[model samples]
Target: MNAPANQIPLQSATVGSDDEIDLFELIAVVWNGRRVLLGLMVTAVTLAAIYVGLTPKLYNASADIYPVNTIQLALISPGFSADAENRATGELSPELLFNTALMKLHSENMAEQFLSTTGAQVNPQGANPQTAKQFLDALSVSKEKSGTRAAINLHGTQPQETATQLKAYLNFVSQAVIVSVSRDLLAALDASIQYIDRSMEQARQQAENKRLDKAAVLAEAADIAAALSIQEPRIDHLAHTEVTPFNDKLYLLGTRALQAELAALQSRKQKDAFIPELRQLEAAKSALLMDAEKVRQHQTSIDAFTLPASILAPTQPAAPKTALILIAAVVIGLIAGLVTVFVRQGIRAYKIRTQSAYMAGYKKEILRREGHYAVL
Candidate 1:
């Protein structure tokens, strides 16, 4: 059956009244637990303040670095130039050099090396895994949006100390880059020198072999001349003619001349003078040796990178933010207190409903027994 319109409106009004009463009860419960809420908030704020006081303050120091110019690149790598062809070799590009520095800065090996060499109070044995990780965690290298510069940031307890350490670390990385380049240059020069030496040696061997062959040919010719009893000059006109030196007619030279030429060739000790290309190889080897020396000498004078700005130490601590921590603590405490109040109210309501239901059931059983007695 359909209910009347007035009846439906009355039922809706009754439901709205119950909801309003419940809302008031909830408010009352929260107000009665105000002391508990205040106590919780105070405890949380106190703890947060204590933590702020106990934690050590950390300051940040940062510096910017950019790629060195072409002149500096030349200083680092001998024969390097600003030409596109040279840059195409990959080893001579300024961008590649700067990226290499960035890679080293982010490497764990570099962190360990810095810890071990700088005497930063690491383990006595050396830079252990934990120490190296901590050092890396405290340091950061980030490139700028323009991609032309990179920033190095470090955290430490003291501002001055942090700035000084950052500067020292930069210097160390620069020296390492320079040394690596110098070592590579020397290795290349040494390789070239070795190649030249091998070529010279091979040329000398070939020349000596040719000399032996020539001597054999001369001895055979001398024997032939002696059998023929020729004194000299069967080929006296052959030298003036366009005939090749190895022509068979040259064998007609007199026995005395052939024997004298063979003896002179056999007595020669040095074959390098006969190798036409050996002098050019010697010159190249000497040039390589000189370049290696120049690289060594320039190692101390060259700069591997350039700093765009000085390292600036921060005056304020980067961590242990007191105000933000305290505000967060207050917010958490209020939330916890509200939750606790609602939970307590819910438990009380459940217990009261349970007791009322149990008492009503007991009374119903008594009434049933009394009615049974009357019926009997």
Candidate 2:
């Protein structure tokens, strides 16, 4: 049989009402189960607190590394000159050097070098893989906004250990850079020494050649003077006798004049003439050698490379952030508790609706059975 149109519409409306849930009803359900919600909130908070309290605390050690402009020193060094090959490499800007240092600071090679330098043996086999891993885990390198410096940070369970590790890492990086620069400087110094040797040798050779030329000129002048003296006797006797002639006297005077001119020319070409120029060249060579020595001193001295600031004790723990943990726990607890309350209320409502339906079906069946018996 077909249900009445009005009844069908009313039934449809009832089903729609069941599907629509009200905000007030949800609030009422939560309120009715306020005890359970509170219990769940308290339980969640307690668990979070326990976990936070039991977790190990980590220490953070931080330091600011200011890369010194050592490239300027290289540019100014007299012994170490940039050749065409070096110029082809381009200028070493502060930014590039900083990035290079930063990369080396975080490199595994540095970690291994550090381990060897510090004698920190971790395993029985003398392999420090674990320590290396720990060091890498703790290490962090980042650039600052000012662009002149970088920040180094490390984390460890102990404050002293963290600080010490950071200091060692910085020392390793600084020493590595200094060693590299020193090697280059030393190599340049050796080259400069060789160049100076060649230059001095050449100067000495030229001076010797000048001396030989002066000696040959003096020998030739001496020969010419000896011949003039031999003729002098003949010219003097003729002047003393009645054969004293005008051509003879003229020849004598002319010969004397030639000797005087020769003497003047010889005087001009004396050793003294080349002494000043040769001395100047020697002085220049000496100065070059001195500058090379100065470069060697600079390389030997550790003052060329400036190390970063020393590492200090960590001011705070890196992990187990108390305020953040507590805040997070509170938020999670509140949410979980509210969700639990709503879920419990929804389950109870479902069970009540199911029981009412069952009861209504049973009642309808009984009524239909009674109607059938009465009709019979």
Candidate 3:
């Protein structure tokens, strides 16, 4: 509003009129002050050019990473037909692109990684707010014409380094930006498969060991039964050897009685009740065998369980795009220029209608004589 040197005030307002702006008159005023206006514009544009040239010529190095889910589009003749599966899988509208871009923008670690790679020194000698704004503003992620893909671009001091670092980080993040229910499911299934394999091996070993022990126990029991049969004949011989003539009749009666009692005891041993102890042992062994089989069967089931899809390693990161950056710079500069013009014009009008400056001297004088000045 303080018209820069030699800018003429083409039209002065009389106190009675509406503040209407005439474009032609305004042009004339500006023409009168064309040197100043042109000088300011030239200065601004020259500075902008200088900044665009000297401040940094950062070339963006970008990583191009496609979503793994979207990788299926590489097919030769993916159905051009309107099938639901095709529709669902193929053109999954960029539902989360905005959120994804925003998340990347707000990502502090990502930003810091970029900052570090670009050798973002804080200018220890001096901290300039305007410089910070320009550099910070340069790091931008924007959507390309292809609605599907996003372009992550960075501006910095060095071209190759900024390009390289930005692409590396952005590419990783882009690939990292995953929308996968299958991935989590696959991981869980893989873990389960591993655990089942370990369990299967253990079950097999245990079943083998139990089978061997059963065979050995059966063999030992047979040997013991044979020894008991041999001992039975010796019991009869010893009873006869211990007898004499005087006690022979007594011995016969005692032997007959003992034999009768032995017969009764042996008859009782032949009953189901007595045999049940051996049956129970056999039942226990059978039960153990059944348990071992079940464990093996469970292991087999685990071995059969398989994951549907495997995760593939990501290729390159998202890339820096020069076209996008230049576009944004042009837009921002124009906006800034427009804003500057309107604001300057408003300020000029405000000052033109300003009566405060004239009254300012009187107000100060009155203030200086606060006790003496009477209100009029």
What lDDT tens digits, residue by residue, belong to model 3 across residues 1-376? 5778988757656733555677886676555555555555566555556555554333443333223232331221112212211221122223343345446654766456545655554421134322434444655656556644554555444444455545444543443333232233233333443444444445555655654554444344334435444323245545656433223222332433434444554444333343323443344334333433333333212211111232222233232333454555556655565555666777886886576676887898878798566544
Runs with alpha carbons beyond 4 Å of true place in candidate 2: 1-15, 69-76, 79-100, 120-130, 196-288, 299-310
lDDT winner between 2 and 3, please give it. 2
The candidate scoring highest on TM-score is 1
Scanning candidate 1 in windows of ten residues, the lowest lDDT window is 81-90
Q: What tens digits encode model 1's per-residue C-alpha lDDT throughout 1-376?
A: 8887777444655666644556777779989999888888888898999999988887888898988888766654544211211221125557776877888887888777887787664322223433777767788899987878888888877787778778877887877877876787677667666767777878888898899888888887778778888767655555566533365655566778888889999999776788788887777667566667777877878556786356777899888888899999999889888998888877998899899999999999999999999999
lDDT of 2 by residue, 1-376 (tens): 9887777444654677867889998788878888887887788778878987887678888887765566555532554243212322123344554666777887888888787778754431123344666677668888878777777888776787668767766876766765665556556555654555565566567876765664454445445546566334366545665422222232333345445544655566444355454554455446445655665566434422345556777767878887788778778877888888888877887999999999999999999999999999
- Candidate 1: what lDDT? 0.75
TM-scores, all candidates, are: 0.71, 0.66, 0.29
Point to the candidate with the largest lDDT. 1
Clashes per model (N, Cα, C within 3 A):
0, 0, 9
- The count of residue-pair clashes in candidate 3 stands at 9
